[model samples]
Target chain A: MTTASENFDTVGLKQSIEGTFRFRKWRSIAVPFAILGYLIYVFFAFDVAGLASRARPENAAVLLGDFWSYKTHITRDNRSGDVVASVEGERKGTYPAGEGPEWVAMGETTAISLYGDASVQYLPENTAVINVPDFGEITTQVNARAVVLRLPDGKDIPEWMSVSRNRVSIDQGNWRFSMTPARTEVFRYQAGWELFFFTLDSPFYGKSVGELIALAIWEPRVTAEHSNIVAMIDGFWNNKMWRHGDVFWAMGETVLMAFIGTMGAGMIAFPLAFFAASNFAPAVWLRLTCRRLFDFLRGVDGLIWTVILSRAFGPGPMTGSLAILLTDTGTFGKTFSEALENIDNKQVEGIQSTGANMIQRMRFGVIPQVLPLILSQLLYYFESNTRSATVIGALVGGGIGLLLTQAIITQKDWEEVCYYMILVVLTVMIMDTISGWIRKKFIKG
Target chain B: MTAHTVSGTAEYLALVRRRRLYGAILVALFFVLFASGFTVAEDRNAGGFLDGLHRIFDFPKEIFAEAFTNWQNLPRLFVAAIPSLIETLNIAAIATLFGGLLGMALAFLSTRGLALWPRLTPVFRRIMDTMRAVPEIVIALVLIFLLGVGPVPAMIAIAFHTAGALGKLFSEAAENVDLKPVEGLASVGGNWFQRIWFGVMPQVAPNWSSYALLRFEINIRASAILGFVGAGGLGYDLKTALQWGQGKYDQVVAIFAILFLTIMIVDHLSDRARQRLVKGGALV
Candidate 1:
């Protein structure tokens, strides 16, 4: 009877094992299928299918091209018959009167060379002629209230040319030409940011690197008022197109916001953490209240805090910093409190065994153990908050983020957007490096 | 013996005094920086700090008063905000899901011992760093220009950032995983994928999930903020209501309540879940 019962028990155990294996096998299949189903649902719910139609590829092309290249506009007044060349058509980048880019031959008829034999000539009387290597000369003239177009012999008007009653436009590979009753314009696309270092009015506008270096080192003064280097520095600093001075100050403000916010939050949260920590607080109610206050502050979110603070502080770096301070205070409070609760406590007892009072004991014992953790956390938050401050700066209308948003909003200043993006990325990376260095040096030491 | 003890004591006292002096200098420097920074910020601000201090509660009081007067409409407004709130949650969820998966791949590819292409580890690391460096608003604003104002742009932007951020954390966890199981699997002639799946993944999944959960919390906040800049979500609605000011403060209140409740609930749930996961991993 004992052998028979043992045999039955073995069979039952084997059956249960097989049952679990089957369940595991089924789950392995079911989980993936469930995840796939959910993703499909999301794909539809997010309207991924309609996204292609909603997306503007042309805008993307414009943005990408504008990032690394600029277009110089050679525009002629229809009635006055005078041609003006401006980079990006901005007032700040306009070439002086009777002057233009080297590629353009300035005279009664301005000839703009656009990449390998394809050129546009802005003749007098609001007339323009575009010559292509493969395609013959295409001429467009503004006649009274209308634009007239003439194509090459034996060739119909190609798709690259668009003709209307009042306007005619031809889009070659890298060059664009358009003629209307009011104005005739030719846009010549060139690689590299135009007037990035020095605007057209600057004496150092088109100097080679070697020449600039020589001038900076030992060459005679380019301008009489100051040395060559000083003048160059002054010119670059006050560059109207790039506004390097303003940009540097904005970057400083962004860093300042992060610095003030993170340090202030640390100062505010460090003391409160003692009250919140279960091991330190004398009463449960006090700890609970502190925890609840932290939750309230954190739950309000930085965006909401920014909104409220902007109302009080108005829009500036101060408002951004205050928002960051309030939000991070809650974060630091929770983390610091947790750190406090986990401390060893033996050291505290050791200090107490000596003739030290409560304040001295807590200071000598509690602080030394937690200082590294606290400082490292503070530094990490400082680095991360630098990025947050950029976004906050945008909302509050300050810093590089403000400039980035403004450039993006204008929809035409994509080059400036690219510049600001690079600056913000570099700033964050530098902060990350600095914080990591500090943490390693101080905490490890 | 008496002379030696006296000299040693003097040296120790001098060291202590020098350390204290350095500490005092550092503290003084910090205080000066803080004070000067405050003054500069106050000066740059449109309203003086003292001027704005009293009016800080004015806006909040007005909002509360209006909300209390329209208490009957509060429930309706709350109900209306539910869809946008869900959309915000969806954006965060989708971003976290996609980002977590990509982050897992990046971690595997970048981790020292487990990297598929160890020679390219630094390249992958640099890529992650660049991705992390870019603020979400920068990408989102640019995408909003290309894709128009929608959650999709915000989702992609946040996911890109999440992948980079979580990848670093995941790799750190993966580095601590024991190599024994991996070697055992390799001895059986298991392929790279199979070995990683059976060995490394089981070791790091718990920690990875904990990090992903934390990222989900952060991404939720990010998505809401992105909405303020034109992405569709509760933030967009909040912006609209807030722009109307005073009269529609009730709507703003309702939105704020929902956002607060959602954030708190999620925070609590994730905290509990992370504790269980981390503890369970330790037990196993």
Candidate 2:
């Protein structure tokens, strides 16, 4: 007991135990510090400190505001001495002459009823009177050289209102009024996306859900060329502002890109996997070549493939699908070959013993073992590629991604971005569910 | 032959025939769908499939030819792209780090027995699902609108996606963990984080790390893609180079080469690292 043996000794064991504990403790502490240090470095590298200053909280507010609601702009031209109302100030969304929403009366004296008790009136001589909920009436006139603002009771200018020699602006988050030398404008904000289902000119534009249903079921035909129901659908489908038909078509194109890309890759990679698999490869060089080919394809990445393909094919779903096909083919080849290489050899040998040809042996013995794996991978890729297709669509200018980017690029139409985002999320979830279902039903069973 | 044996043989043949018929129908269905999908794609495409097929190599050929003719400039172009490449890698690395931490928390919260508040598991799960469902580009573009243009948005967007994805995997691993260690820790008055860190972490760290590593690989690609959408990285460089047209083909080739090399190297390293981590984890 006193003599310490080489193999077993209390002192040696104690020392080793203490050393391991010290190392473990040191690692536990070092890891967090290392992560923190890296983050600190990344903080500077990403210019995170400047990010706040660079960030536009106002732009974000406008964007978030636009997502749920829209604004109708009523403008009175100073030169013409005339007033007009339009949804979002677009020519296509212009209200017909002397016609507007119930809250608006486009006559010599244009009156606009905003939310709550606030209202606005366009008077003669390009003057505007804004009725505040709490404050008294404020008058603003846009003359040739200056904008005159008359506050209630000679009140000093508030923070909410900005007045200058040529421009006057009053902002109430929901509604705003601005008078310039050239024109006086009022923007009335309302909740919900306006003109989503039907444009201003459509007879079906302002109908309530119940009224629309009644119109479809029993009411007289709104348009002579089409039935009432057909007219409603046509109005919604051909909506100028929202473009529901085009949006749906783009969504479908995105999905189709995924489906065709994944399936096409699978079809190509399946045969290639056999030649690349070590046990089944016809020759060494061929196997290496196939493997290297896969590595090349995968390494090139989809972004490159999309760029290169778009040049030849131009901007379309076809380009996106081909890019995905090219990239996934490499992935499938590598994975499928490895899967093939890992196959149990006894089955193949047993089939061969029955005097079966090589093809027959592969058909009977090899395929069943790997089919489930291959199919599951294909399904998973199919689901993921739906998302990739969206990105690629953005690159290739094809699908819902195109619409989203275009809407974003316009820096207006954030509601469309929100709509497209929702649709993209839903489509991805649906694809996930479908793939999961297939995996469960076919593979697990 | 006996009547009973004859009937049995006939039944067996019928069963085989039915299976064959089903297989044939499935194959035929796939072919039909493939054909129709291709036709639809062709109809909608700017150029016909047949025309585009022959021209697929044209761009690659042009780029490579220009790159080779300017071969002496290739090395310099590659060097110039290194900073952008590093930015891309940093985005991936930082996103993975942050996302992995978030995923650990999400996993712990959503895992049934391991959850601090077991009843809130479904809520956390749905949050993860929603996060997962959003493509990184959506978040990136929105953030770009808010933050102007920078790599930060790309990092955040990728991390968000990585969190949701890694959470799902991490929770799946956590769900299969033995509860004895957790019970042991609780008996000693360890807190929730303590129980997870000391008891469950050792068991699941290897799997979680492996998943995170794979996500890092994916995030690298995502960061590059995000850059193309104005997030500012190598993809941005590549985009500008491509946009410059003929004169900048060498730079385009250089970016592609660097990207290809980085991906290949990282993939190789991670493949090796994952194998080691898993094996070492099992041994311990």
Candidate 3:
């Protein structure tokens, strides 16, 4: 019923449709299979299976525990027969002789009341006794040669206790007791960071909130030379355990590095961007050269720049800022030039028709269109650079990153690491909010 | 009418003058701040800015001189760096893959209309925010303590941060997607997962892929930096060579060249690919 040409067209259309369907069917199966195969390869490549054995779950437990709690060490030296109670075993947090937490009754016999009915007592002659609620009392003695432990009647050494030739340690849920040849010690685990506000040397060490407020407002000065509030701030700032003042300064330096780096890069890039822009540059070679320069700067990477700059500037905020500046200059140059290239040419033509000079044309036409984009970009970079400065500060040996790395390197200062992490997070979030606000208020508005 | 026109012109002139004056004052204030901040930074630095400016090229020149003399070693050193470079790339690629998957779940959970449980949206958002706020270096360093030095720590750290970063961008894109298809899917008795997978995902996939690509670029840099801090990669090799000082300058040059080339190539390719995706060209 159809002509020959019509029949040919019908046949071609049928074949094309069938081919497309077949291709789609193959693609759908092939893509997923390919991805699955790649993932299988990556699994072996990254050694995901070996990770379980290499991972230290105990270290994770220790880190998590250290983040939220402090331990008080109650020790009696067998040779000197002197008892000392110190927080986290730090000398700065040590309670003075004969002065300890109310939970500990320090006298001829020192009793540490732990959670529940469990308690540890330092008896005379380098001996210690622990009473668990369900179990009978267990005694440990530190002699000249070794530590000897006596278990409760018919009670084998439980899984919580570890015994050796010269040492015996019993780890209860909230309290731990250990006896060695040299000393008998009990570590009472307490929630919250101790000595965070005021050190033991301060007169306001253990004051309640209400009492501190009263002291600050109506009460007589705590220190004769200054008011209660001033003295309180002084003690808090100079607290050897916390070092709040140094931390504050380090945070400021970090912010300063970000600000200087971001704004400086913007200033440097703005002028150079014109030469890189294809629409603005008078000479092709100049445009090409500037573009290459930007690429080279960016390609060098910030890490390399930091290493090189630190070598010159000798590791400080300046080196960090400069490193940020150099890397961002390349970034801003590329982005700004792209922004410039995308501008409406009609506006420039309009200004030119008004007999304006080049500078005037740029100011009246070009800047108006691009200023918002440029500013939003700059503000965004500023916010991110605040975080980068922290990492960069670590490399350059400046800012809060230095303190954080130092704390982390100590392996035992996990609480301080926790504090620094919180501060860094807070600072970054604050910057993000501020920059978002500025972008909304100035650029979008 | 003439008097009204004169007053209007006068008012317009006054407004212009005021705006110009404000701009000038802002510029002045910025310059002042810049100058003062520079002075403070210079004071804190071990070497003054002016003193260090001239000597900046000395180290570079020394390295170049050493490297130039050992030009025969360049190719061998370049070959030596290939494995570390691959490791670095693998870190970035795996992080992007894992982070992109996590970010998708987070975005779906947090975005309105697309959310499975809208009440928990803010909770998921806050979690992402916290994750993003913690820098990769902090996590990497901490994990290094537990896992020891390897690409895995850096990989996990970058992945965590990338998830948070990409989730935010993905959610923003998802928020702007048309809800008609989702409603249509739901009307057919499709479940929550089916509705999102069939309806919202197709619309936002391009934008999400573009973001992931950008994040991939950033993660590359992050992985390298983390490597510099003891994670094993090209950066670790570079550090070791640089520590050896003069004899290993050739290795340093080779590493630098490899890194520079890799970054440039990736940047170029990604830029082109993003343009194609955003411009609605056929994806490769």
Candidate 4:
């Protein structure tokens, strides 16, 4: 009888184990197939096949080029018969009359040098000559009715040059030439940002680092009223092209929004959390009301809060900060209340034994227990909110986000966008490091 | 010994007092900075905070009045917003799915014990860090330029970000997994992929899924925001209706309600799911 019972137990155990393995086997196979099915549906829904035709690879090329290079436009107004050379063709980047980059010689016939020993000369009568080394000179004339083209050595037109009715264009990666009835233009692509340190008007615009250092140490004041060092700083700080002062101010506003928002949320939520915490709540009804209020605030979402606040306060860092404050208050209230509820009862009981009032008991017992958790939460949010502030800043038209969007909208300022992207990333990482350091020193220790 | 104890008490008291003084200074400094920062923010704003604070409810009041008058249209408008809301969710869901898959791969490649190439662990870690640091809006805007205005741009942007963010969380979770199973698998003839898949994945899957669910919540909000910036979803709908102003406010209210309800529902669902996932994780 004992042997038979043991045999029965062994079979039952084996059957149970087999059942579990069968379920696992089914799940392992089913989950992947379900996921694959969903992805296939998304593929069609996103119109990914259509994306191939819609995508602008050319724009990507332009963006990549603009990130590290600047183009100097040498153009002659066909009717006016005058050539002007400007970096990025911005008014602030325009060279003074009769002067241009070293490679560009401004005259009746402007000779602009290009890579590969190529050169473009704007000559008499709405005509331009482009020299392509390893190839021959290609001359194109913009007449009243049509563009007349001549290839070097009677060579067939290369695919790089596209000509249409009354217009002609030559495309080389480093340089480009275009002529219409209105203007004959040659854009000479150069490496690096144009006048990054000093604008066109600054006397110290083209000086090397060694010369700049020498000027700073011993040279006479470049501007009579200010010393060389001051003038140099003035040029850089007030640089119109880069807008260094504005960019720094924007960065400060972004950080400021995060600081005020996170701390302010902590200040407001700390008191409210006590009301919401189940163990600490004076009345059940009060706890429910506080929790519901938090739910409402959180449910409203930061985007909606931002829109509503911007309507009230108008667009700026103030509105952005307020939006962050309201959203974080909800988050902090919920988390802090949970922390309060989880505290050791003995500590609170000990504080109560001293006949301390509610406020004192909370201050002495509850706060001591929860302060580390609260502070760590605040620091984490503060670091994240810095990044959020950029987004909020974009929406409300205030901080680095605004500048980034504006730069992106201009499309030509991809380099500026790249700069702002780097700055934003660096600022976030710095905040992350600082918060980690603080957390280590105070909370962990 | 008594003398030593007495002196030690006094020294400890002195140290405590000095620390309190430093704390007081920090608190005072923080208050000053907060106050000044608010002032600067107010000054830079187009309108004064105090003046605008009183008028805060005016826009909400207008929207409510308009919506009340158009009460009958509310249901239809609500129904109309469902598709865009779905688009928003789709953007988030797709992003979370792709991001989770990429993140899982990246986590395995980066985790110390589970890494396919141990020498290149730091390289993969830095790549993940760089990816995580970039804000979604940056990528969304850049993709908008390349892809034109669509949900695809927002989806891709969010996925790119979700990958990096989830990858970091997943690697951290994977780092703490018991290595015995990994060794057990390797003792047999299991390769690197098999070792990670059979040994490491089961242990970390629960924690990683919980993080991904939380990220899905975040990506939803991100998708909506990206839409407002021209990625095309519920946010774009809200933006257009808001732009129309007075008469169209009923539509705005509908969009807002739909978004709020969706967020609340998602929040509750994900919260419950995470609780279960975590509770079950202990058993696994």
lDDT of all predictions: 0.90, 0.90, 0.91, 0.90
Residues A67-126, candidate 4: write the lDDT tens digits: 999999888889889888899988989988888889988887888888978998888987
Candidate 4 lDDT (Cα, 0 to 1)? 0.90
lDDT per residue for candidate 2 within B5-106, as digits (tens), equals 999999999999999999999999999998898789778878777788899899999999999999999999989999999999999999998898899899
Q: Which CAPRI level is candidate 4? A: medium
Error of 1 at A50 (Å): 1.5
> Pick by DockQ: which candidate is best?
4
Docking class of 2: medium
Question: How many clashes (backbone atoms < 3 Å, residues ≥3 apart in a chain or on different chains) does model 4 have?
Answer: 0
Say which candidate scores most in lDDT: 3
Task: List ranges where model 4 is wrong by over 4 Å.
Answer: A1-15, A125-127, A142-147, B1-3, B281-284
Give the alpha carbon lDDT tens digit for every residue of B1-284 in model 4: 99999999999999999999999999999899999999999999999989999999999999999999999999999999998998899999999999989999999889897888899999998788777778888899998899888889998889988998899999999999999999999999899888888998888878988999999998899899988998888999999999899999999999999999999999888888899899894322
Q: What stretches of model 1 exceed 4 Å from their correct place?
A: A1-23, B281-284
Chain A TM-score for predicted structure 4: 0.94
In model 1, how large is the Cα lDDT of residue B70? 87
- Per residue, candidate 2 scores C-alpha lDDT tens digits across A192-237 of 9999988999998888999999999998887889999888888889
Q: Which lDDT tens digits does candidate 3 get at residues A146-211?
A: 888898899999999999989999898678888888888889888999999999889998899999
